[model samples]
Target: MTRSGTDRRLSDDEMASWLPLIRLVQLLPQALDRTLREEGGINHAHYAILVTLAQDAEAPPTLGEIARIAGLSRSRLSHALDALARRGWVERTSCSTDKRTGSAVLTEAGRDMVRRAAPAHVAQIRALVLERLSDDERETLTHLLGKLLPGIESAV
Candidate 1:
């Protein structure tokens, strides 16, 4: 079938192709959330925030920066940080350069928590996602995803 113009709507095959990706995106987060919540008393987003702080070169990042990196709103991030702080998993410190700005640091306990949670998280990811792909498919998917990333970043 041909459209009147060059711009065409998605074909059935194209739509079908996206179904797996869409389902994966939806289910993976839920699965991860369930696993983390059960095992670590933290949701996937919380785990991600802690891991991001742990991986940061400074071992801490400004709340604003953390919110940006975490793709969460400042208010939402603040709430999450508050929860984490209450759980004793993270510490907020006044920035040396800017007293008004605060940084969130993963505590020793947080580090240990993340370290413990990591293996199960990695295993789950591998089992659900990576292990399903053949080596060639993995390489191709990585390359294609890398190529698409710049455009996504630019759009954002």
Candidate 2:
């Protein structure tokens, strides 16, 4: 059987589960951005870029790879990299095998900055997010969200 029109709306149970999650999805990034800007002098975008690069600092990944990991478009990542480069925190080099391709390498300064920011950033996350849930709830949340990621990624 097929339902139509008003019958298509979310059920009460579904709404109860979704509303808070929707709000958190909308607002958490802003809160984290505010904290990061105040404490680290960087916004979440820059922080994400730096963190991704630092993960493979010895062999920097290509811009496309970084873009995919950071969930940013190439143009947006390029702009952020430009700003970081001006701050002397990251350097971009043309790929040795393909001059048209580029990769971002974290500078010593960038590595140090991420290291300095990590502890406080993690603390902020704990205070705002993790501390709100019990250990079992946290585990369940991770498991539930992980189940959704593949579908979400494919939809995009």
Top candidate when judged by TM-score against the true structure: 2
Estimated TM-score for each candidate? 0.82, 0.85
Give the least accurate 10-residue stretch of model 1, judged by summed lDDT. Answer: 1-10
Error of 1 at 68 (Å): 4.1
Candidate 1 has an lDDT of: 0.86
**In model 1, which runs have C-alpha deviations exceeding 4 angstroms?**
1-9, 153-156
Candidate 1: Cα lDDT at 16 = 84
Q: Model 1 — TM-score against the truth?
A: 0.82
Which tens-of-lDDT digit does each residue in 1-156 have in candidate 2? 343557868777778878988999889888989988888799888898899988844466899888877777899999999999999999999888899999988899998989988888999899998999999999998999899988976776
Clashing residue pairs for model 1: none
Inter-residue clash pairs, candidate 2: none
What is the TM-score (0 to 1) of candidate 2? Answer: 0.85
Displacement of residue 19 (Cα, Å) in model 1 is 2.1
Instruction: Provide the global lDDT of candidate 2 against the true structure.
Output: 0.87
Query: Would you list the C-alpha lDDT of every candidate in the order shown?
Result: 0.86, 0.87
